[model samples]
Target: MADGTRIVDLEAVPEDGSYRLTAEDPFGNETELILVRCDGEPGVRAWSNTCPHESQSLDVGDGAAIRDGAIVCPRHGSHFDACSGECDDGPAAGTTLPGVDLAVADGAVHLADDRYAFLHEGGIDDDEPGSTSHLSL
Candidate 1:
């Protein structure tokens, strides 16, 4: 967590499939990131936790829909690749979620890029509905 990048304890996330991460930094705003780990893959990935369609928090309800190896948005049933952030289905079909760059070291996940080191990327309201949050993409 050098440079004050928020760090998440990797061991705290489930290795099964997908999970939500509300990444926060004391000196920065909170960003909702989704933690993903697919079968046969050895590491964890963090994604912006917003459903690009409505800019709704992807983890707002019942967690991410993990089916057929993609993370489904709970709000509008949008699908995104667990590892690639590719929009596999739904409204934003051909688009990819803006990936939150991450690094793993000493059993933790840290921000890989300082540009998005803060949670206020693209001026998107991470918790609002009908927001143009995909500007980060």
Candidate 2:
């Protein structure tokens, strides 16, 4: 087990929101991940930013909605356990968010997932399609 890439200090994680970051997989695919405060030894939990129901990003630049120790999906109001990534409500019930391995040590969170390499501190900004909502007058 490698030490992994250090992403952020545990103390810097928001107590009520999420810390978003981007990572690249071995296949050169970029994935957005969100880190949320959790209860237990690690003190942090990470999950892919996509919602299972529609694959929409859980965070839309503000941060994923978090409540009662769960990550609330912004698209359809699904609630996923922060630590377990298990959705128990909304359209995504019974589904789990893809998890990214992490290591918490010396007060910092490290990206320990062997399948991915840390890319940046936010979502990918490129030609990928996004929201298609019509502009309001």
Q: For residue 78, what is the lDDT in candidate 2?
A: 94
Each prediction's whole-model lDDT (CA): 0.64, 0.85
> Per-residue alpha-carbon lDDT of model 1 for 1-137, expressed as tens digits?
33446556778665544555455546667666777765533377778877777887766533566777788777678888877888867887888888766777777766776545544322234444323344454
Candidate 2 on 88-134: residue-level lDDT in tens? 88999999999888998888899999999998786676223332233
Report the lDDT of model 1 for residue 75. 69
State in Å the error of residue 118, model 1.
Answer: 6.6
User: Which runs in model 1 stand beyond 4 Å of their true positions?
Assistant: 1-6, 16-19, 22-30, 39-42, 118-137
After superposing candidate 2, which stretches have Cα over 4 Å from the reference?
126-137
Best by lDDT: 2
Worst 10 residues of 2 by lDDT: 126-135
- Scored by TM-score, the top model is 2
Q: Candidates' TM-scores?
A: 0.66, 0.88
User: Can you give the lDDT of residue 40 in candidate 2?
Assistant: 61
